[model samples]
Target: MKATVERATLMKSLGHVQSVVERRNTIPILSNVLIETSENGEIKLTATDLDLQIVESFAANNVETAGSITVPAHTLFDIVRKLPDGSEVQLNAADGRMAVNAGRARFSLQTLPRDDFPKIAEGDLPTSFEMPSSTLMEIIEKTRFAISSDETRYYLNGIFMHVSDDAEPTLKAAATDGHRLARYTLARPAGAEGMPDVIIPKKCVTEIHKLLGEAGDNMVRVDLSASKIRFTFAASVLTSKLIDGTFPDYNRVIPTGNDKLLTINPKAFFQGVDRVATIATERTRAVKMALEQDKITLSVTSPENGTAAEEVSGTYSNDEFEIGFNANYLKDILNEIESDTVELHLADASAPTLIREHDKSPSLYVLMPMRV
Candidate 1:
């Protein structure tokens, strides 16, 4: 293929596609990116690792000849990233190598037959809908932090997306790692009825977030089948295979009927937790929270390290309660909450604590207490 494209545009597209391609692959072609030129003077870039695939198309200048080839993803991306941002990049294929020239620099990269690249079959996606990019971003940011990194419970390694009937048919995203659970709900989009529950893998969630993040004021088209899901945004399309196992029923884990409520300044609580956590044990990293009439004290005591206690004034009129939780988990929830105040409902030290934003938010966090 022979084409002239802007260096910045080419680098940006390569950065997205190469991230999906694995550094080491048993199949050589999987490590390369497929570049093809169309009759309409548009260039298509594609990369895949069998389970996930990304395809993007962009308009390029002057196509001398129509052809297709595969080049090493890392090498090509490195070459483009080092070149001047707005310089005109020219690429031509000769024999089994691809030549790239921009400004005064020239490089030749080995190419593979584009036919060897795997293509994810486009099936008839019966369930298709569109959602505002911002809505999807909110769900991802709120729940992705709680996704389990434990490979054994592969089902919990991704976010669970389903339709909920609580009040209305709201779209719910939940993630859990046995210790903490995060759930967020959004108003269901029009024509999103009959969508099945799907567990999108963690990698797919991250990739889709990057793809839709810059899509300002645009809606993303989502298509889901039995085993795969596809996201189409702007000029790119990403398809990923869904996790096979079933996600645990997260509703049972969320605690209800927690009576004691403590409202605290979100910023102060987060900073207190951050400071006291320094003295916590390396393994548990537990921070104790003691709640009294209108005062809350955060303390962390370690056998090796000294104890630390910080008092934060709060709005509480309930009975005295004390609880211990992982400092990291508490910080994660606070970071996701976009409100000035945070409400923590407690039943007892042993039971799960429910956390909510002071404002109206269709989301809640459940954190399992630890033995201090």
Candidate 2:
């Protein structure tokens, strides 16, 4: 393989593909990226961790020979990344070594046979749809914070996406860690009808979000089956295996009878919770919120740390009530809210609370209370 690619373009593409390669690998070829020159004289880079794969193609300045090679992903990325900006990078592969050349630096990495690189099986992605990149970004960003990290409940480790036609046709994305849940819905896009319910792994969700940030106003193409999902936008394509487990019936936990209304400024509430949480114990990170006539008192007491209390003005007309919540969990949900005011509907101190931007907004959050 022989090609000359602009340093900046190659580096940017490398950064995206190499992120899928893990730091440690049990299989030698898994640590390498496949580089190939296409018939039309474009350069393609591919990296995979068996479960997920990303392929990026870009136009290069020159292509002398058409061939393929596999080289260490991180090493190649680091070498290209260190090259001076606006420089031209020349790549040559022969004698089982791939050589990189720039202004005054040279790197030769041992290559693995291109045939040894494994590709994740993509068997007939029957369902395909297109949506604006910005819409996809919003759906991911609003709910990803609640993804579970516990390995025991493997099904909850990612965001659940499905089409809901209950009240209206919409695509809903939801995530929960058993302590808090976040759900966001948007009008279903065309061609998304009859799409299978799928759980997108957290890693794929993160990488797709990064890709969308650069996509601007472009549209993204999504193709998926019950077992795998693929995203294509710009010159990049990402394929990931879906989490093979059943997601719990999330609608059952979303309460519909919470009547006590508490309206507070989200920014003020976030700040108050953060301040009082400073003295909260590390184990629980619990903070008590006492709601009265027109004010809310945030308090925290730790055995090792001192106590803290702050009062924030709010609008509540119901009887006084107190509830305990994990400070970190509360702040995470609040960060996703973009409105000036947030409404919290409470059934009781022990029942799950419903939080939203307003009664009409499509986004909803449920946070379970903790004992302080």
Candidate 3:
């Protein structure tokens, strides 16, 4: 393929597509990006890692002839990025090698056959809908921290997205690591009817976040099939294979009748945990929470490192209660809360605790207490 493209445009598109290509590959073609020029002179770039795939299209200035070729993703990206921002770049494939030229610099890269690149099949997507980019971002940011890193329970390695009706036809996203669970809901998209529950893999969640962050538009189109899901933005499409196992029913883990309520300044609580956790050991980073009539104290002690304690002013009228939780879990929930204060509902030390922002919204967080 031969084409002349703007340096800045090519660099930006390559930066996005190249991230999908793995630095080390079992298959040589997987390390290269497929570049094809259309009749109208637009350039299309595609990259895949067998599990995730991305295709991006952009306008190019001139086309010598319509052709396709595969070239090393990282090499092409570096060559374009080093060129002057507005300089015009020319790329041509001849005699099994690709050549890139801009101004006074030129580089030749080994090329792979485009036919060797794997293609992700576009399955029959039964449910298709459009959701605001901001809404999708909120769902991911709130629940992604709780996704399990444990590969044993492979089902819990990704965010569980499904339709719910406790209040309305809401889009609920839930994640759990057996110790903590985070669940958040957003208003269902306008035409998102009859959507099935799907577990989007953790890698897909992260890639979608990057794509949405760069997308300046308002909404994104989502298409879901039985085994795969595709997210389409203005000029890019991300296709990912869904996890195969069944996700655990998360509702049972959420405590239903937690009576004790403690309202505390989120900033104060987070700061206290941060300070007390300093004394905690690397292996056991546990912080103890002692709640009384109108005061709360956070303490952490390690056999080798001694103890650290901090008192944070809070509004608590319930009976005396003490619980221990992983300091990292507390920090994750507090970081996601936007309100000034957070409400903690507890039943006992052994039961799960419920957390929510000051506003009476549908979102809630449940954390399993750790043994102190």
Query: What is the TM-score of each predicted model, taking all chains together?
Result: 0.98, 0.99, 0.97
Candidate ordering by lDDT (highest first): 2, 1, 3
Provide the overall lDDT of each model, using Cα atoms, as 2-decimal numbers: 0.90, 0.93, 0.90
Give the Å shift of residue 175 in candidate 2: 0.6
Report the candidate with higher lDDT, 1 versus 2. 2
Measured by TM-score, the strongest candidate is 2
Tell me the TM-score of model 3. Answer: 0.97
The TM-score measured for candidate 2 stands at: 0.99
* Candidate with better lDDT, 2 vs 3: 2
- 276, model 3: CA deviation in Å? 1.4
Q: Candidate 2: misplaced stretches above 4 Å?
A: none
Per-residue lDDT for 41-153 in model 2, tens only? 89999999999999999998999998999999999999988889999999999999998999888888899999999999999998899999988998998999999999999
lDDT of 2: 0.93
Candidate 3, 1-372: lDDT as tens digits: 789999988998999899999899988899999999987989999999999999999999999878999999988898888898789999989999988999998899999888788999877988899987888888899999999999999999999988877657788889999999998877788666778789999999998999889888678999997689999998899999998889999899888798899998888899899999988887769899999898998999899999999999999998997899999899999988888889998999889999998546657899999888
**Residue-pair clashes per candidate, as listed?**
0, 0, 0
Q: List the residue pairs that clash in candidate 1.
A: none
